[model samples]
Target: MGNIVKSLESSLATGNLQKMSETMDQFEKQFVNMEVQAEFMESAMAGSTSLSTPEGE
Candidate 1:
């Protein structure tokens, strides 16, 4: 009985670890994609004008 319980616990632990690892991987991928989008937006905003250009200087 004790051996069976131990085995079951170990299996559960392994499964949980695997799930956590997958979650972490997914989160990292999402974070990287977001970062890229942010960078693109930053660059775009830097050179963008608000349709208000002054007359010829």
Candidate 2:
């Protein structure tokens, strides 16, 4: 809960995609395990990104 939020926030601040993904996985697991009702929201910008961009390109 709070931990995941902090972790994900730090990841976002540092632009750490790996950390973000891992934190999100944990977050999702917690919610699903608790049977928490979820509603996902998305905007058009959600689909307009690549997962990989080389470090020094």
Candidate 3:
């Protein structure tokens, strides 16, 4: 993420539209992947919590 931001800033400083666009695309893909992983983790945690709880309480 930091790398992507740095790349974007560098591209902007150098007036490289193509590099900026590519960096943005890469960032978007990484963002989407992170979201998916987060959702999966949340679901896995929820499942574990339920399994560990007492049957009646």
Candidate that beats the other on TM-score, 2 or 3, i.e. the better one: 3
**Residue 24 local lDDT, model 3:** 98
Best first by lDDT, ranked: 3, 2, 1
RMSD of 3: 0.7
- Residue 5's lDDT within candidate 2 is 97
Tell me how far the alpha carbon of residue 53 in candidate 1 is from the true structure, in angstroms, after superposition. Answer: 6.9
Query: What tens digits encode model 3's per-residue C-alpha lDDT throughout 1-57?
Result: 999999999999999999999999999999999999999999999999999999997
lDDT of 1 by residue, 1-57 (tens): 354455546656787776555556666776799899999998777656433455552
Q: Write the per-residue lDDT of candidate 2 for residues 1-57, one digit (tens) a residue.
A: 999999999999999999999999999899896663332323223433333545575
Task: Provide the global lDDT of candidate 3 against the true structure.
Answer: 0.99
- TM-score of every candidate relative to the true structure: 0.59, 0.60, 0.94
| Model 3 steric clash pairs | none
How many residue pairs clash in model 2? 0
Off by over 4 Å in 2: 36-57
| Consecutive 10-residue window with the lowest summed lDDT within model 3 | 48-57
Q: What overall lDDT goes with each candidate model?
A: 0.65, 0.77, 0.99
Total clashing residue pairs per candidate? 0, 0, 0
